[model samples]
Target chain A: MCELLGMSANVPTDICFSLTGLVQRGGKTGPHKDGWGIGFYEGKGLRIFHDPEPGIESKIAAFVRKLPIKSEIVISHIRKANRGKVELKNTHPFVREFWGSYWTFAHNGQFKKIKTEPLGDFRPVGTTDSEYAFCWLLGKLKKKFKESPQPESKLFETLEILMTELHQKGVSNILLSDSKHLYTFCSTKLSWITRKSPFGKATLLDADLSIDFRKVTTPGDRVTVIATNPLTSNEEWNLYKPGQFQVWKKGQIVFSNE
Target chain B: MCELLGMSANVPTDICFSLTGLVQRGGKTGPHKDGWGIGFYEGKGLRIFHDPEPGIESKIAAFVRKLPIKSEIVISHIRKANRGKVELKNTHPFVREFWGSYWTFAHNGQFKKIKTEPLGDFRPVGTTDSEYAFCWLLGKLKKKFKESPQPESKLFETLEILMTELHQKGVSNILLSDSKHLYTFCSTKLSWITRKSPFGKATLLDADLSIDFRKVTTPGDRVTVIATNPLTSNEEWNLYKPGQFQVWKKGQIVFSNE
Candidate 1:
């Protein structure tokens, strides 16, 4: 019982608008109030802000909502603490380095028996099934391919297979990134929306705020946002069926298993 | 060259007072204006703030300086780029995970050819000699000890040997932590100060700031601050000799190579 938010953009973009709505679910409009974390990728460097406090009351989250830190890829999570104790170490959107790239992952559902899975080089610092699952996924990737596999399709295929295994364990809706692409596997609930040319005004579902994309974005700007639930009431969001796997690059879906 | 700052405390303590003076050196008092970063350890979790902008003017740095986020261990850096371009990826205070602990590293000197060193599992996300050296060191440790080594002294000795090799290459002042101990290696310059029961007032060297440690601390609290150069003007500081390696725990020096 958590919430996830992710973004991929053709240009560096901020998630303040989406994040403003998501933070409401952290405490105000919903019950996911244990802790919150967000990761923003600025080139190859990743900056993460983690607060054990409820996101609705987090000073850091307020600062982040106001300060527009632009990034090509972003991952964020608000926790309800189903598998681990509420602490800074158990905050979601966990990160690790593999093959010279920073990989970030956020999960929105539970896995019953992920802890029994063995880990290799990557180990979880916290006692969360979500983190254990991330380490397990990354360790499998590292073991199967000594280096980043060439002809990216091979890597995508491997990810699909691994994600399928995780889905079999339990509800495992995931949003992951390898600095270059955003990979998503939905076990239960997920939705996404892409804004490109002719972008119009949208109102937040949780708050009384509206933004006209035409005023802020250029025609060339393309941005994709994925979340466990729709953040905007006006915008149309595409729902993913269960067991769907997708790879997104530059705000567009490059591969998908329907 | 860059500037480094670190802290180890017997109790959870804030480094805002020390960081206030150090950030001034990022552009106002010294030449390290390329970027800045700091990591604060909260139990087993770590929170880091990195800015490619100069610390003197960075909004993030200003917010961090005002927030009294207490931590038991801290590592920070202000960079003056030499080998790498001025970008977020090349900012100081790099991080990696090993043996279920997050290891953070910040370097204050140069390595002439450290990039040529071979690596095993750990890899650098940025193109910096300091990060290369960290990768090489951690990779060697992972290779030698399958798990965390028993008998902590053995790990310290192994670190000393690895750091000596780094010192041979060039100037390699380092501050590293694995959520437990603060490991320091000095090639040319480093200093430390410990404050306990008899707290006194101190004045900053780079900023118009003064703090009375008596007003903020209790008698049982012991705190150690390490930096490339002493941060305060009035406090007496202990200087590390060239090629010195030390391990610190709970504000006390556990082992040192004098």
Candidate 2:
């Protein structure tokens, strides 16, 4: 098994608080210690950091935990290496450019023989079933919408159908983004929380740390955090039922199949 | 204009010493201060860091400069924003995956109105002439070589033709890599140096830093560094002539059109 963390914000925000807790599970609190990767979007430019080392001991991971790289959409993963070997090429939160937009995806579950399907233009550089699925997802989208752009609702509709089909294969708990929206699908375990005005203190579940959101955030700020498991003990997290798909934007769920 | 720095080595090697000097040109030593980026390939896995801020003052740049991350191939750039706005999307050292390998590219010079060419599957996430040229190059390759992997000689020959076409459009000093080979084409300024058994001391041109290769490297290691302009004043560097293309492997020029 693996883990995933995602954030969407109305304004540029940092994931340091949530990241601190997640890194603990990468080795200390959990067994997902093979490697880790994270992606943050600053406008259309996406910055990705991949370390094929345990996040608990990686120097770059520590550097990222302290650096205040702000982004409107963020996705992260810690791997346990169920389907692929523990290597940099197999690190999660893979990114590819499609339709003039940078899309990022990370998976938290395993599947077999997912590569049995024919591929389009996108190909996986690694041997992970997760990456193969991502390539399939993006390749299908690129082929369907080859021209300019498509309406968000139409795209979401297409994605829902695809996700439903993919969920039938195996566990498909995934977090994906197309630079404009954060799309999450629940096949097994997933939870999410949104923070806005009147934010209070929240304590981490995995680490010995806590943050006073009222001191760090403005009233206008709205942020949504989605993860495989709840990272905080105090905050109320909404659990997603199996086969549910949600599209989030500006820190809130804009569309959902609950 | 902008600046480029690349490395190819038989053994995994850290580029911190060379990157330290190149980042200085981002703002402290030169005028190419719009943004900066670098990609390091650990096997087929690539780790890329991009900053829209000037490298001189970027905390992430500072972090990357000190890290001991090693790679067999590396590509980096410092931008001056000739044809695009100063944004993260427009940063240099753009990457795309093809043929089950991550290909990275960076350009030193630029021209406007290059998007007049019809694009294939690959599209530019940023509105930079450099990225547009890269997409065209890769899209052509993906279309022509849609089967399995082609022979390296055939691929290089195709690249040489594409380089000639792109060079005709503008000043196309570029450093590109397909994880297996480092490809460079010089329309104007580019230089390279190969370090072998007889290690020597070298000094940076932009920073007050020096290193003795004897202390850090083994006798069997071979490394080649390529840059838009010579990075070290103390080393003997070979300058590439205009319209020359070189394919480098394991720190040596395996093929070239001198």
Give me the candidate number with maximum TM-score: 1
- Candidate 2, fnat value? 0.91
lDDT of 2 by residue, B155-228 (tens): 88889999988888889999999899999999999999999988999999999999999998999999999998
**What pairs collide in candidate 1?**
none
Model 2, position B133, has a per-residue lDDT of 94
Compute the lDDT for candidate 1.
0.94
* Candidate 1 lDDT by residue in tens digits, A1-258: 999999999999989999999999989998999999999999898989999899999999999988899999999999998888999999988999999999999998888888888987799999899999999999999899999999999999999999999999999999999899999999999999999999999999999999999998999999999999999999899999999999999899998987
Compared with the true structure, what per-residue lDDT tens digits does model 2 show for residues A1-258?
A: 999999999999999999999999889999889999999998888999999899998898999988888999999999998888999999989999888888999998877678898888789999999999999988788788875355678888889988887898888999999889999999999999999998899999999898999998999999999999999998899999999999999998888887
Cα displacement (angstroms), candidate 2, residue A205, comes to 0.8
User: Considering every candidate listed, which one attains the maximal lDDT?
Assistant: 1
Question: Fraction of native contacts in model 1?
Answer: 0.83
Structural similarity to truth (TM-score) of each candidate:
0.99, 0.98
User: For every candidate structure, what is the RMSD over all alpha carbons to the true structure, in angstroms?
Assistant: 0.7, 1.1
lDDT for A235 in candidate 2 is: 86
